[model samples]
Target: MDERIRHLGFGHPWLRGGPGAGDGGETSRLPWLSSLLLAVLVLVGTGFAAEGQPDREPLDVFARLLLLAGPALLLLRYRRPVVCVLGVALSVLVYLGAGYPYGPVLITVAVAVFAAIVSGHRRAAWWAIGLLWAGHLLVVHLLYRHLPPSGDAAASWWPEVGVAAWVAAVLVGSELVGMRRERWAHDRRERAAAETRRADEERLRIARELHDVLAHSLSVIHVQAGVGLALLDSDPEQARTALTTVKAASKEALGEVRQVLDTLRTSGAAPRAPAPGLDRLPELAEQAAGAGLAVELAYDGERVPLAPGADLAAFRIVQEALTNVVRHSGSRTARVRVGYGTDRLTLRIDDTGPATGDEAGGSGNGLAGMRERAAALGGAIEAGPRPDGGFRVRASLPLTPKETP
Candidate 1:
């Protein structure tokens, strides 16, 4: 049965019987049970009222049956509230015209009105209420027109007052429930949007990390491979050394790539190798030298410890800067200077002007990635053609730890 319902596109969890079946079943059953119970009460109350008024005409079989069916019709209220309201109202009018004693059929009408309001049919609810009131007034006028004026006018008016109060309560209660449901739905939508934004930010962070890790290593490999090919026959020893450099750089790049993949496979739970930092700048410069660029590292002031993120960002900045020197500057020599200050660390990389006029103006992802790394740490970077006819990349990053407390 559950499979069939699902196949028919009625497969809401609330409809499928399983772990939460009890709750769903109870919810589905409660309204029907309550409507049935109200119908029984209406039947018993009307019987007592008819018994109390000995002078009232006994209802014919058809009228009595219709009065009893009024509340039963309320079972449809949840699915077809408007129809139920109209059906019950019409039944009440027929029963009353048959000279039967009034019963508690109005309870079902109240339930129908509440159902319609909560179902987002406020306009229809109002129409139903108006029609019911008009019918009630018509019945009252027709039934009491030929009767003599009674002394206790308040007693006769009490039923009308009670009916108005019941209707008002139903409408107000339904509106409150509708408002609560709307608020719940809005909260769910907000939570979903927040999760999507978080996922997007995480993806962008990984992409940036991969770009930084692979770009510099690949650039070195490209240079070394070219050198190996050029000297393969003439200077086999030098060519083998170049090939060795290529192998080592490729191996290190693969390890870093594997670490990144492991982090992703484990959903970032795996232990990661230590990230490269300023301390690795010497090795990075050596790799640049092997790639045919003579690189020098210079430091000013005493060495200061940096926050881990800041250290990594500084290293990447230098790595990318050296890469640009090798690929774009066409410079044979480059200088990297690190300065430790009172509250921050600054790095500068400058390359001798291009070897020839043709290689002066090509820029790519290296500079942009370097800039992003610096800016992410509340730092700034400047990269452009230098006044002395070379290219310079300068970055200043704060030494402040991310978690001070």
Candidate 2:
């Protein structure tokens, strides 16, 4: 109901309101009848004058008033359609009642009847419509006190009912067509909005993933580059090994970025090799210890073999968590838990970071990337600063495979 009112411009006729209301389309179709009918009437008046038919003697003044007023009512048909119609009916009846046989007013009278039919008020239109046409027949005959020409029932009655009924049918049909047009327009807008939302979500996910990949790899390279620079004056061979680690991590970051881009370009996601999972936690623990951070790896629940994507997601979650700890935590202590339950794979990372600022939980996209990876695999995540003055990253991926196990 609200939509309908909006479409009709608050139902104010003074607003020049209708469907397609805001634009000039409603007024685009010119009212050709006003000009055309008057021009034809001018020529008609000239022709009748040439014929030199004698004008009628003066009748009651009321009859002349009606003759003047009847067709003028037609001009206001749409704005006050019923009033215009009723006025025409009464005025024309009075004109005939006072004995004018025929007049030029029938042009506007015919138009009024037809306008009423074309609008949706068939009942009002039909009644006034009946009086106008029926009055024409009765007036012509009774004034002469004789039957109309070719006065058979079929010939006389058929044109009136058939023409009016056809006009009413057209009005109803047009309203139905307008309804379909409105429905189509609404559906088109909704579909376009949905597409726009999907595009936005995809861009955000891409941004988060890009940040995680670059941040993780760059942090590792920064460590190795520092070691190489330190060992350059001490042990040349160890420095060369540090450079190799930096090179390998850099190459890995480039490959990850390219794979994400490839998936976007063709919408054909390439298979990613299985990455670090719970089984590789020992290596992560050793790396943290080497970096002078005490990291404990623990597990509960059933040990489950994760899919390749889930494994990589779990690895990144832990990686980002520990990286954040090293960068922010004053204490060199962190704990990671990989819990493989019956229906889900969970990775929980906790660090004794200062958790001082709003960014204590890693305000960057590392946490966001973890969540996105889990969500893409039909999963969930919750990460923020712990009340115990630390940060935690917990992610869960559903065990169900994308296709089949």
Candidate 3:
């Protein structure tokens, strides 16, 4: 029921205000006021027309007032369109049967029909029109058979023709108005739904970005902090170096986090720094070594440039793979191999075996995050214990040719 009122442009503003409500509320009221004014004008015109025709008898004051009442009642069209239309139809019948001047009394019927259709009461509107037309035919038949005729009966049909045309015009106009209102409402709903979907997607993207950034950086910081504490008594100098690495890692993490926050604060209006890509793999290997892992990087085939999405995914996958190696693998050595091909880029990170301690149970989002990134770019990832007795992560990212400037 509420939706119907909204589509008809008559919903209460304070109860359900939103875009277009002001205009819609005003528009919905126009039909009611116009119907009332039209009815009043028709009542006044009937008096004038009756006075001008000396052959016609003036209607009693009570009958004229009743004719006026029909249109005034149209003020309730918005609240109860079907009832108002039916009431107006009955009043018009009474006025005609009482031999009142048939001036603009028909205008009241037309307005009632229009109100019913505009208010989304099509069946009621049609029924009211049918009743009016049948009554009109009956009145014409009575006039032709009982009244003394001065001219041909064919000429008397003109009034009925005019009334039929007026009713048809009202029906078409009301239907057009209703259709336009429905279309506008549909468009507004679609735009709102689209905006909601965009917001959801953006939130997911930001979540993935924060998860990847914090997880990798925090893992490195955790390992270096452990090293610093373990060597504090045995090798004071090495302990200081470990502490220094921790400070540097923390600073870098802070800077990256600030960048992300700035982007969010500005609503992405500010330009961002270049994203990390495959070129940063060597630097990543160095950082892993500083965290106590023995790291080696190798490449096979000719290196080719990759699109921005594929490049970022490849970099993140490798970063996550190496972080896992440093934290979970017990062995000291790990190998990273990049195999470039004509259609795709392949990355492999393998560690010797499982490590001791609680590192394995650390936040388990790393592998899942890597897989999400790879799948987002139409790539694939595989990570598990290798048959050679160590953990391995392999990712394949398909390449797209760079667009020419």
Candidate 4:
């Protein structure tokens, strides 16, 4: 099979307002043109031969041999797009040697330029368009003296010049249209990739939410169960009380788990209690007190209205901070402060204890969860040792979405 046959195109099918991606059907025009040009060559050669004109008139047998190669060159117009433009233009030069009319051959050159830009090199395509028509003008002005000039004043042959000018203009205009189509294709791909990334990130956020719900509840239950098992021998009554606390905590954990999983795993709407806000700080303090941590709750400023998202985010930030204090900070007493203002809400959890060892290594996902919650609120958090003793975690969140109406 010939390699040139593979690249022949039937022009663009989406010339009208059609889908850009289309199955390009055969146009049925190529064979017709090939036959017409062939008939022109045979009839003209026979008539002139009957008139006894020189068989080697201007383009002699040698030049006709190259002209014989022109149709084979036409098959190459779409293949080596840039190279074929020069080939057709060179064929035009060879045709000029035969005194053949140059009008019809210019279209093949235009098609070559159009093919180049559509193949994705805009600059090369543009240059090909210019140089192709320029070849026509150079041939007319320098080589073919038989053609008429422009009004006896202009050096350019106005007939051939007009034909070449339109060829260049149409090639360039077609390429501009092709560029817009290519850019649209590029933008569509980028948008699809962005949407996929957003979906993946959303799935990850839900995963983090599930982890937070399960880990906090399970950690509390694990501590209570261990205490109950330790007291099973001597303090059987206390052991029973610990088992009751574990059972209640486990039931509450199940409810929290259901709410979270329902929001994620199904289309059912989440519960509306507006989530936990700054108003629930005392309740959290009381729960910490039950767990044998000395909790001191404090507040400052007015009860400013908060965006529900900000409110819930603030509450979770403080909850995770305090949970870390219980598990890692080894602090006897923890102080939690909630300050509400017109513009923003600030939360701080400071724990005071004997500073012994640092919390590091294999601790997995405790402190990182606090930072993640804080970031989700469009806020900032810091956890590190304070000056005197113990550790502190502070997070600040805005009352409303800043970039929203």
Candidate 5:
């Protein structure tokens, strides 16, 4: 085959946009310019090669049409690969058997075979190529005397070795290309699936954050509003203080909510305020106190800096546990113990006595959110009724940081 013709056919657009080429195995359009260029090259190349093979039959009208048939058939390769390959192979075989000059006419078969394989018609492509090879064998060894170019004698068997090698090379190279394309498609699907999972996890995290922020603040506001309403007639001064607590709680809640929203608004900008951590424990306790649940804090060891993810998780776990106590427990006090070890941070929150209502467990997402937070940080959260009396929530968090997804 002419090198230029081979190059042109190999670079054709049909090869890249064939079936299963990332367009979901659908043929969207035709490669008109490439097909025309290939057809022209095949015709011109064969005409030139015929001059070098004066002993063979000269280029005639029917012979030129056979050279053009392969490229014309390839227009349907993506949609009808089997038919296209069969048609192209048949035309090439007929041209070969007719004693016409051999040149880039083989390029047509190459293009058709490649397109068929790329479109996932490997068996059809193999059959087509195999048919061409067998037909060449018959024409060269058994039927040459009865064919055109009357005085031609039988060709040597050694060239058959090169032909076999060429066939093997074509099949091997086409199979390699097809395998690579399949791998590329698999990688694309994996990346897409991973991105979807990350999106879902991010959404769940945002929902959990919103729930914690609103649950704790709203619970406090609900209690303070009740206090303000009840003490309005009895003690105006206490009622004013209760209203003040409500105002402060609502304001803080708004700030936190805005911070969360800011993260969404800004793609990668820094947060307006730092995430809450153990340093804000006193503030958390004060808010719980405002809601009529007095909190006691006990520190067991020295505090150290923590990774941002672990710090945030620790803070949220405590906040959610305290909120649970405020909503469910009959006891008015909660004891929060913080132990700072070399590699771990332990937190224990307990409330004395039984629960307030019949449904003491408090059917809410607070506990589940805490568990998720701890688990995300490679930590664990345990919550249940104490054997003695009250409810207890214990969490163990690692000091090591985790990569942000």
Candidate 6:
């Protein structure tokens, strides 16, 4: 219900005072305080104006009541701006018809008009102010002699021109204020949306980083563990080597996991170590060998410095592709090719053979993570079975610097 009212630009319908009482995103207690002040100003100002205009009817109980009526109606301007403006305008018209002295009394109607327009009720404000102006003209020009203070003559057209100008000024000023408020609201919404988008992108990046780190390390540990258990009884020495490889892989995995966690704990802090890049390819090949998979590394172009983002993406793509080969392929050999270009870097990993092993089935998140990394760096990844037999993954990453999302 509250959201519905806010969306309608009326604020809370039941709130008549305090913050958020007014409509169209007003959240101050100014309206409440201003209402009280306006009532007093109108009463006192009109009494003084009456002293100067001896030809007008003297101040009476009904005249004072009419002056206060407009300000009283202003209390509901925020929650019901259109209704408040109409009531205030009517009070102003009746006060004029009664031949009461005009002074700060018009101030009440101006305030109502401003509120109505700012609250997104522009048409209602126009009608109320327009009717008030027409009614004032009618009383002063045609009905003056019949209405109040005896011997009153009809008002001149020149004064009516000034009244029309005042009305136009009020309408223009109200429109300006409303437009400014809407612009401010639009900027705030845009900033909030940008913040939300950045947060989502950060979460996705972290998830992909964690997946690449754990998947490759765990695959190596799994193969070494299996070897250790199989040879434990007959060949203790070989089993010890396998155990050593498992321990090393697990320790490296934990280190990478801790590095990723450090980023979450320290906002905007420099990383304890630089992110892994293509420089780590040899280390990856060693790890794959420990998992009973031999990886052959080849280069196709002259080595050139890569942007940090592109380098990191290239390394991860190769890592994920090799990890997939280790888990899913029957062949024990995989080949990795790195091609450096003028504006982009290409990486291709191929394994020769058919599928095998219990680890052949996977959640498929590895390929997805690789694709996301390449895409983030304005690149693309293609993974499918090579027409010959084994599977292949080819990735092309731009060399351009990637802005932080």
TM-score of each: 0.68, 0.56, 0.72, 0.68, 0.83, 0.86
Candidate 3: give the clashing pairs.
Answer: 330-354, 330-355
lDDT of 1 by residue, 1-405 (tens): 978745743345322222322222332553667877887887778887887765545656775677667777677655555555556767776665455676576676676666656555565567667667776666566544543232211125568887788778878887887667557767988999999998986776677677777877787888889899999999999999999999998998899888878887888494478878899998998889888889999999888767787988899889888877777767889999999888888999999776354442334566777777888888999988888789998999997744555
Q: Which candidate model has the greater lDDT, 2 or 6?
A: 6
C-alpha lDDT (0 to 100) for residue 156 of candidate 4: 51
Model 2 Cα lDDT, one tens digit per residue, 184-224:
77798899999999999889767766776777666667667
Scored by CA lDDT, what does every candidate get? 0.73, 0.62, 0.74, 0.60, 0.85, 0.85
lDDT score of residue 297 within candidate 6: 98
**Candidate 3 TM-score to native:** 0.72
Return the candidate ranking by lDDT, descending.
Answer: 5, 6, 3, 1, 2, 4
Stretches of candidate 2 above 4 Å error?
A: 1-168, 234-237, 269-297, 305-313, 330-333, 352-363, 368-390
Q: Tens digits of per-residue lDDT for model 6 on 1-405?
A: 878746744344323333323444553433668899999899888888888998887888998889889988888887667668888999989988888887999999999999877776776788888889889888988888799877899888998788888999999999999888768877988999999999999889888888899989988998899899999999999999999999999999999999999998997888898889998999999999999999999998788777777888889899999999889898899999998888888899999968885644456799989888988878999999999999999998886644555
Segments in model 5 whose C-alpha atoms lie over 4 Å from true places: 1-26, 51-62, 78-83, 97-100, 118-123, 143-153, 175-194, 233-236, 357-363, 401-405
On a 0 to 1 TM-score scale, where does candidate 1 land against the true structure?
0.68
Off by over 4 Å in 6: 1-30, 141-153, 357-362, 401-405
lDDT of 2 at 129: 52
| Residue 388 displacement in candidate 3 (angstroms) | 4.3
- For all predictions, the C-alpha RMSD in Å is 8.4, 9.6, 6.1, 8.6, 6.6, 4.6
Better of 1 and 6 by TM-score: 6
Worst 10 residues of 3 by lDDT: 14-23
